[model samples]
Structure formats: C-alpha cells, structure tokens
Target: MGFKLESREASMNGVALIDDEGRWTLLHTTGERPQASPQIVASNSPSRDGAFVPEVRQPLGAVDMVLRFHVSARGGAASDDPRYVRDVNLAELTRVMRLGRISTMGLVIGGVPCVQRCVVSTSSSGEELSENIVPAAFLVKLLDGFWSAPLGEDRVAGFLRAAEGGSGPVSPVWRIEGPCQGFRAVTVDGVVCEWAGRVDVGQAAIVSGWQSWTVPASLDEWWVHPSAVSTVNVSDSSPVLPDFSGSYAVDVFVDGVKQTLATTKVSAYCGQTFI
Candidate 1:
C-alpha cells in the first residue's frame, strides 16, 4: 500500500506520498468509479408523446481522485522547531501538485502497481486537522480516465498477445522486425491492420530488418529499400475490439512462414490495471 508521484517539476519527481520521517503521510485515497462521458438523447428519435427518448453513451471521460495526506510537524525535532519545516513542506506540496502540467501517479498495493496520468484539481493542501497536523489532500483529475499497466507489467516481448480487459481499445506500439515478406496484426477487438510487400535486406544470408508499425498513427518511415507495396490497412468493420484476453491473431510472413523469435519483439500492452 504505497503511492508515488512523478511530475515535470524537479521538486515533485519520483516522490513518495507516504514516508516514515517525512511530513507528508498518505492517509487514504479515493477515486470515482468509471462512468461514460455523458448521455445524449436524440430529440426526434422515435420517442412517443411525452415519453423518454433513447440515450446514447460516450466513453468514460475525466475522473476525479483524491490523495489525502497528513502533513505534520516533526515530533522529535530539537527545540520548538518544525514550525519552519512544516510550512515549507506544505508549500512544496501545494506548488508541486498545482504547478505541473500532467503528472503520473503510481500506486502499488499487494505488490501490484498501476499508473495513470492526472492533473491536480482545486481541492488541495488547505485544511488543518489539529495543532501539529494538517490534513492536506491533492485532488487529481484524470482526463484520460484509464489506468494503464506500466510498460513492464506482465508483458511478454516477442509477440502481439494482449491480455484483454481495458477501459477501451488500447492501441499497442507494434514492432515489426524483418527479413520477411509482409506483416499483419489483428486486435481481438476485430481491428485488422496489416502491411504487404517485401522487406528487402539485400541477398545476405540470415539477415533481418526491423520496423515499428505505430497504431493509428501508422508511420512508414521505418522501412527502406523495400518497395511500398502497401501499409497497415483497415479492411473490415469499425476496427476491432476484442472481448477476451490472449492472442489477437498476428502473422509476420518470414519466408512465407509464421512468427515468433527473441531478436524480434512486440510489446503487447496487455492486462487491465485498476486502482
């Protein structure tokens, strides 16, 4: 049960919200349960007289989270000190939280960690709970509304296999290594994106080349010499969103064969992280 905060400001970078000898002690945390952005009801969408119209749902929007901290003066400080120390700590807390752009909040409970981006909201670092203690809290607004499993959690690096269950469709950063003919990656969500044409690495034996197929962005600057037969294209429905975890069916045609290797890697941003 620990909370760590990282922000662009040097004063707040990699700071532990709770520390044994520090003034800021994390007391508790709270977050709003995920909800749709908002509902929109069409005016004339087959609604009976004076009856309710069918509403449409947008995806989850920003969420507000609270990080409560107990800012206290040092009990064992020599002389009646800490008066200066505590005030400085409070000032640091206020500036660190409110002055930054977007901060990354990381929480680890039961040895499992999850991360989310947040901006400090209005309610923060104000109330004094007692003589020597102030119950200061940083109210964080999560604009993206999704907690992402960090780049190094439960990740297997050689193939495109996402362990499903995300707030929505997560587009992974696909790395395509080659000496191959073409490549294709299909999300379990039914989103089909593939590339065609040969990866020309000259007539060298056991040679391999690499390219990263960025999601949605689809940058083609990664390849060279290989004729641009085609890039990763969407052929079917509204892209795809897989309902289950596991492999979403991927193929890298190496000499007209299937895939998997250590030299080659695919960072499947798999698994769901909740806080």
Candidate 2:
C-alpha cells in the first residue's frame, strides 16, 4: 500500500475522513468528544464577559488505525484568531470523502465541527509530491480518552482555495475574477487567496456556451461564468480541467451591494503537460 503524505501548512480548519468502504465522514474534534452528527453542533457566539471560550474534543477511535484526513485553508476571511474552524455543507463533505483519494482531503475553517489540532497545507515550493506531508497527529498526541487538541485551532477563519485539476496530456490554467448574479465568489475577495491548481483544457468539447458556476463559501467571490471545463478542477479526476473557450461574466458584492464584471473571450484550450 502507498503511504499518504500531508501538506504541513498551518491552517485553522477541520479534517475530512473517508472510510475503506467508500463512505465519507468528517472528523470534528470541536469539543471533548466526537460528535455523532454534524447537525447537533452549535454556532459560536460572543462570551458574556467578552472572552472567547475555546473548546477541545476527544478522538472517536484508535489513532493508530491510521486515520486519513483532508485539510482546508480558507473559510470566511483570513483570521488570526483560531476559534472559528471553517464549516462546509454536508453534501460537499460527502462528495470529497466518497472519492477516497489523498488529494480530495482539505481543511475547513469557520466551518462546522471546528477541528483543533490538524492543519493541512501545501509546501512553500508548492510541489505536488508527497515530501510536503504532515498529519495533525504528529503535532498533537492522542490523550488517554482524548487528544490534546491545539488551543488555537478554533481561531481559524479564512478562505478555502480549491486545488487545481490535473490529468492526462493537458495542463489547464484558471483565473478567478469575481462574482456575478446570486452566486458566491470564485476566489476570496479583499484578501489574498492561495490556490493549488492549474487550468486544464480537455481533449473533448466541454462548453457550448457560458454557464454560471456558484462559488462555494470558501472563495471570496460570489458567482461567475464557468465553462464546463472550469468545473473539472473540482471533479473526481485527479486534477480537474476546463475544455472549452468563451467569454465569462461575474458579479461582485460589497457591503451587500452588487456589481458585474466581464472577461474577454479567451481560448479555453487544454494545453500540453509538463515533462
């Protein structure tokens, strides 16, 4: 069996786990014990005296079983405080877990079941190789019935940059302008968002016209016109690729106000790959 490598970038996000039977489960060490369901968790609020209550959690099972997890970096906005482990929708979490691959794993911040110890990140050089791996267990050990969760793990609130889609003979490139319509931002606005992905041009004709794609709460923008190819980066394929060409439109919102942005039509050709 191949050993999984983790990216060691410090992120205030929760880890996602996939079972050996193709089941997707999210592991939240938010409190002193593991939560059986994600719905029962409570949203955070200000403490009466103005102090934040930091919560830690216990592991659900044996750590030595080689628990696998995915880490995320961006959530609401880039936050220095570590209490807001990012939250994600049940469907999205399930989708990633079902794939059962190391790359599908991502950290979630400001997200549900705020994880307190594991931080997933890519190497500074941004190499896709496994040398850039680090698991949360390495940083914090499992305690008798509980793990000594990181104190500041909850203070994580920021953006979630999706990894680039890669595969086959084509290496695609992607750029996020902003949001449009009722959609969310493709890339985090106002803050600098870091993404690990490439724009892919597919061998097949994927887009006949422009299509609107919703930005998961992770990025800073709202919605933008995504050719079918842009959706590939988020697909089951190792690296998602875009396989069409067209003009894109995006809408922007600030202080609840709306705006529209457009991109000149460009060739969405799936280009040649690296050696």
Candidate 3:
C-alpha cells in the first residue's frame, strides 16, 4: 500500500519534528514515502498425538518500516551550500539517530492514518557532494502490532452483569471508536479489577469499532462477607441476606490523559431459598 512514515521529528512533506514532550526540534525535510512490511509472530504447540496447534499471542507485531529523509538548511539556501546541508542539517539528523529513543510514529497507509510506538533499530546516511544534500534512512521496529485509531473522545458502553437468576458467563461487549490505550480498571460495586492484557489496542478492533472481554466471577471479592455462619441449628433457622447489587465504573485513559467518566449499572443476586 502507498504510505507516508513520520515521527515526532519529521513528516514526508518536510514538517518540523517535535520532541517527546511535544516541543519543536531542529530536524526538517523528509523523503517522499516510506517502505514497510507486516510482521506476525506465532507459536506451535505439539500434542501427545503429534498434532500441532498454532497459538497467536498479542500485542501482535504489526509493521516494520524503513524511513528515509533529507536534511537540508532550515531556510531557503543555494543547493551548493555545504555548510547548511552538511554542517547543520546532517549534524541534527545524526544526533537524533544516536539518541536511540522510542517515539510515536505516524503511518498513513492506503489513505488511513494511524499512530504507533516504535524504536529506531538502525540508521544509515550518505552525503551527496554534488547537490550538497544529506540523505538518511532508518529502520524502525513497531513495538505494538496495531495502528492506534484516531485520537478523540471515545467510549465503550454496555451491561456488565447478567439478569436476575441468570447463571452463565458475563462477557461485556463495548463499542470502542478509533484506537485507545485500553482501560485501566473495571470497578464493580467498589471492587476494582485491573486490566491484565496488552496495552496497545489492535487494528482489527479499531476497524470493527467493537470489542468484548470477560471478567471472572472469582474477581468479585466484594461479594464475600467476613462474617458467615458455616453451621446453624436445625431446629431454629435464620435467613441469610447478602448484598449483590451496585453500579459499574470503568476508568479509561488515552495517551495518559483522563477523559470523561463512563459508567453502567450492575447487579449480583445473593438471596437464600425459602423452605
């Protein structure tokens, strides 16, 4: 697919680069396009009978990119000026490569733009004395296999609990718009359960705009009572009542910033049979 690769430092059309803190940097002028390839990793498990089963783990490796750029004078300068191209532009690009810091990269493939966290694995540069220009290329490895959806206000809303007298798995489905960093914690009746999954939201989920996950009932520590009667007199029996109803709260952070609060209703049944 046709693509444009960009980092905080530069874009294909020669925009100024920004630092991790969103501050402007000295690098400018990027190449026309970038070359990228998809990366997928899987493992095969052998059964006792000799049959193999393939398991795919996430965050899936998404894409590796070869980014190219041209470093030149900040302002308009004559093509023959060696000082502007070599002494200034090349020096800045070299410093950036040597730092080896992880940065957010923008990839626009097939008319869609997505963001990814990546690290520069390799870099090469050569000077063109005739044109007084320095061309540099970098090999970037994507940390997360998914392209982040567009950044904006997005929410996942749905019921997290089953109906009264219902007994089954409760897989809460949420509609997520674009890409997100995922939820931090899901709180049910004041009991909090932290997310134990990949931080990067997958591209397929973003495209579908929906995702579903299950939280084990064992995680409902709040439903347990410290004081409970294991044994009771058969002649005189007392009814036991437990609270199993509350609201569900979910805290989600995008790009490390807290957005609006999203919540849903939840209920748990804790009633004893009457004989």
lDDT value, candidate 1, whole model: 0.46
Ranking, TM-score, top scorer first = 1, 3, 2
Candidate 2, TM-score vs. the true structure? 0.15
Sorted on lDDT, best first, the list reads: 1, 3, 2
Candidate 2 ranges with C-alpha deviation above 4 Å: 1-104, 112-136, 139-263, 267-275
Number of the top lDDT candidate:
1
Model number with the top TM-score: 1
- What would the per-residue lDDT of candidate 1 be over residues 1-275, giving only the tens digit for each residue? 23343212112235666654666676534433344243344454454444342322233468776666767676445665555667767776676575447877666523445566778766565656555676676667776655555442222333334534343434443334444444555433332434444434322111111223222113333222333222333232122234445333443333444445553422333454442
Better of 2 and 3 by lDDT: 3
Q: Could you tell which candidate, 1 or 3, scores higher by TM-score?
A: 1
Query: What lDDT tens digits, residue by residue, belong to model 3 across residues 1-275?
Result: 12132443343222334433222232224433333333343445443444333221112334566665544444435554654545566556555554367767664533445455677777777664234445566777756654443322123332222221222112232222224433332333321222222222232111111222333323333223222222211111111111344222343333344445343112222211110
Which residue segments of model 1 deviate by more than 4 Å? 1-12, 29-60, 81-84, 98-100, 125-127, 152-169, 179-182, 201-275
The candidate 3 region of ten consecutive residues with least summed lDDT is 232-241
What does candidate 2's lDDT look like per residue over 1-275, in tens digits?
23333322222223324323222222333222322211123444554443332222112332211232333322324442222221232234434333222322122322222122322222111121232221222122221222221111010111111111211112122233222111122211121111223222221112211222323324321223343334332321112222232111222222234323232211222222110
lDDT of each: 0.46, 0.24, 0.36
